[model samples]
Target: MRLHHRLKEKVLESVSSVLPITVIVLILSITIAPLTPGALILFIFGAVLLILGMGFFTLGVDMSMIPMGEGIGVQMSKSKTILISLAVCLILGILITVAEPDLQVLANQVPAVPNPVLIFTVAAGVGIFLLLAEVRMLFQIPLSYTLVFFYAIIFLMAFCTPDSFVPVSFDSGGVTTGPVTVPFIMALGIGMASVRSDKNSNSDSFGLIALCSIGPVMAVLLLGIFYHPSETVYAPSEIAVIATTKDAAREFLTGIPHYAGEVTTALLPIILLFLVFQLLFRRFHRHQLLKIVSGLVYTYIGLILFLTGVNVGFMPAGQHIGAAIAQSPYKVLLIPIGMLIGYFIVKAEPAVLVLTKQVEEISNGSISQKSIEHSLSIGIALSVGIAMIRILTGISIMWFLIPGYLISLIMTFFVPQIFTGIAFDSGGVASGPMTATFLLPLAMGACEAVGGNILTDAFGIVAMVAMTPLCTIQLLGLSSRLKEHLPPRQPRAKEEVEDCILYFDAED
Candidate 1:
């Protein structure tokens, strides 16, 4: 009965979460950018899969990821063995990132490095940074100083990196911290911080995701310079030629197994790693182990379905619709349309949910979930607007990134420390699979139409999506900090009342 109840709740939540994007796309199709019958059918079927997939995925994270990360954190921190703890964090980071489905999609797009090489390099970057994040939290290092320093390194590296490699490098940071990584990493931060029992410990729990994000940027930037990865040419996105319902079904049927195999291959490493840890640590009780096992199953199935749907249904639609709009006389409309999609689509990102909920919980409700959602929506909308403009204009991403990061970094010192942490983490979370799948493809199609350099112009949508949140969420913090600093009104005093009464008597 409880199992059924849990599943039902997740299903309902997933539908609500996914419905807005579905409506937005449908509206766009019916009015402005008409979808072919085949694409429409794919969209509808994919929507169903998305709803189901999100339900399972979120619930699975709650069950498996949160507990597992906490357990690992607690045990590692309890030992107070730095070498052992760092090694564990490093291994766990690589293993978990390797399992991220979003990264798979990203890997396929970058042809300069072999898929495995790019994937592993990004994973190593994440692993190293996750290790750094753990160390920073343990030592009580300020998130701002760390971010400013590392990002300086990233920028320096970027100068030498080929134009084609720069966007992909920054984008790797965003996608690496998606659905698979966020929950576990955030929870791990919480668990580790719990061991400290200090005032700053709660704040310390946050910035792991923040720091982990930088590692990928830095890693990819250096690799790009070394490899000198060139522009990747790709065959056009596969369009579904659905003459009938049977063909639509056939496209989806064919797509599912491929994603299923990929998701399974990804999950296997994590499963084996967990089993090894369990054997050595024996941290979880029987009931807990059984529950985690169940959750992993849900996570696997959910990801397979989700990836299959997005790749099959959403990607083709995004490409076709984007090309159509860009080719039309009204090409400039891409900016607003992109903005509209950005505002809604971000809320659907699975990792964004993880970050917001975690922020609210960690802050003890000082940061409300509704406020985070609003901030993220506004930031991402602006980002997509900026990205579309770049796609049309062929501007360097650095034109925006340098100024954006400067503002964010400057605001960091002005806001409360925790807000800075959450803000950076929000940047990472906001650019999950949706940005990779829908928005990136949209930018690519438009880039193709405009005859712009796809690599340099269209590819930084994820990075832009990631950048805006750093500024906006910190602005939320800055706002809250100002409100707290506002002068308090004077209280009514008995002495003042007496003085007033005496003055009245004297006047009389």
Candidate 2:
């Protein structure tokens, strides 16, 4: 029954995402005629795999990762030793981030930068900031104040970094918190908060992702200071045509094993840690262990299938469509196309659904899942629109980011604390793998055609994804606040109450 429910949710979310893309593709094919049949087929195939993979990945997170993260959070907090908890948070943050697929994808695209250095720098940033977040939560520090200090550093670093590196730097922060990171981090927050027997435990549980995001920005900024890549970097525009079953099968098979291996490798350390802790502490029940193990299996299979389909099918189509559109007379249509894709893609984001449902459940349905989804859709729409604008124009990312951060920071003061945390985290969670794989490449292809710097113009799709959610989600939060503060119905007069009771009894 549980499996059936999960499957239903996954299908609903995945269909919501793929249906829009399919509609857009049909419109483009009939009216625009830019996307070839082969490209369209591959894109559809890839979207299926991506959606399925996301579903499986999200399910797996529920089964395995969240439990493990929460277990660790509870255990670490129980120790009440600040240094131990801090070290654990730092190490786990770096380790998990090092394996982030989205960050790996971004690093591969930046030609001038060495992939390893970029990966490590981003991982290190996540590590340090994750540690900071845990500490802040433990100490009951003000989230807004920490955000102000760190963002101030990021802005300062932006000035020192070269023009080419700035967008990627901001983007790294967003990409680092993809599907792999969100479940664990969110669970960790919940777990840590559980240990706090305070009235504001829920509020304190919310801002880890916001803080973790700071790590990558600072790390990349520092990287800019040290490693200046002098060569011109451009992302490739050619699309690989997959015409035969052999091609699709071979491509899918090759990637499936690789991702199977990768997901296993990525998850092994956390699993081992969980085992060790379980042995030493004996916290969880036998049934819980069985459930988590089952979840692990689900996660592994889901990741393998997801990666296989995406790498084999989706990527080539994304590039092709973008290139074809760029060459079209109706090229400006890419903005709307991108916006449509972004809106649907949020539904496909594995963590977004989890976060929304969890929020609704946690808040006792004061915040509805429908409301959360609506806000995220609007947020992503704005992000894609802005990203398309960037691709078309050679606007520096800093122009948008500086103002966006300023607004988010100021809003933090006026809103409820829970809203601020969710808003900030939403920035990272909204971007996820879909934006990294499809939207970023779409921007890059546009940049390639217009003869713009790919890194500066195209790379910040993830940043836009990260930034807009801050505004949109907080706006939702503001709306919720308004609803809460609205005056209640005046007490019924004695005659009115008696009349109502009499009417009710008569109806009965």
Candidate 3:
């Protein structure tokens, strides 16, 4: 009965998440960038799948991954063996990240480096950084200092790496904290915080994703130094040709097994890890265990469906729309279009919902979920708009990234510490599989049409989507902080102040 109720709620959330994108696409098609009928049909079908898939995925993660991760964290904290705890976090990080579907999308796109190697490199980076986050939480260190330290290292490495490799490297970081990894690892941080009776432990729980994001950037930059990519080989491909609805239907049908395998591989290790940990600690009782197993089943099925639809239905349309707009007379329109898409697309990200709700709960409604959502949308809109400009003009990604990170990091001192951590984590959550599947392809298509380097110009859309939020959300924190310190609005009116004085005098 509880599951039934949750299912209805999730379905409502999914519709709200997906419906805007559908409407935007429809309006674009009718007015300026009409999709081929078959592609249109595929996109329509994909939207249906996306809504159902997200609904199931949200409910499943709530039931299974959250509990499993928190339980492990609690047990690991109880054990009091630092070495063992570090080892477990390390192993857990690599395992969960290896099969991340977002990472898979990125791995397939990067040239020269083998996909498995890229995956492994990113997985290891995540593990190492997850270890760092755990240590930071255990010691109750300020999250800002850790972020500044690692990001400084990441930027310094960027200067040494090949230009062709920089954007992809940064994007790797953004994609690592995706749907499969975010919930468990984030909950893992929460669980680890259980041992620390400090006031800031909850805030510290959030930065694991932020630190883990940096690892992939550094790892990929190092990989780029070793593996030089040829400039010409990184060109984007022509959009897919879909002659009929039958062809689009076939395209989606063909994609089901590939994503099925990918999502199954992604979920398998997590299931095993949960099982092994449960056996060792017996944290979950029999009824809880049954519920978790049931949730895992939902997660697995939902992911398979979600991935298949996004890759097959969304990618081609996004690319075609980008190419069409790029080739149109008023090509600068890509900026507003990109902005609109970015604004709405983030609302559809599954991990985003998880992060926002957690933030609201953690801050005790001081940080509302609505505020986070709006900040994320606006940040992502600016980022995507900047990305489209980059593609149109062939500007180096460094021009945006260097200043963006510097401003965001500098803002850390001015805002609330919790917002800084949440803002940085928001960067990764906002750039989940949806960005990888649709937005990057859109940029690639536009880059190709504008005669730009797809490698340098096109690839950093994810990084941009990941970046702007750090500044925007922290600015939000700054705004709230100022409001708190504004000296009670100067007593508004003299009469109002006199009434307060009279009340106090009567009490005395």
List residue ranges in candidate 3 displaced over 4 A.
231-244, 490-508
Which 10-residue span in candidate 2 carries the lowest summed lDDT?
231-240
lDDT of 3 by residue, 56-139 (tens): 999999889888888998888887689999999899889989978888877767657788989999999999988888788777
Pick by TM-score: 1 or 3, better one: 3
RMSD, one per candidate, in order: 3.6, 4.2, 4.2
Residue 170, model 3: Cα distance from true site in angstroms: 0.4
Ranking by lDDT: 3, 1, 2
Better of 1 and 2 by TM-score: 1
Candidate 2: pairs in clash:
none
1 or 2: which has the higher lDDT?
Answer: 1
Candidate with the larger TM-score of 2 and 3? 3
* lDDT over C-alpha atoms for residue 319 of model 2: 64
Estimate TM-scores for all models. 0.94, 0.92, 0.94
lDDT per model vs. reference:
0.86, 0.79, 0.87
lDDT of 1 by residue, 114-169 (tens): 98988888889999999999889878889899999998888988999887788888
By TM-score, how accurate is candidate 2?
Answer: 0.92
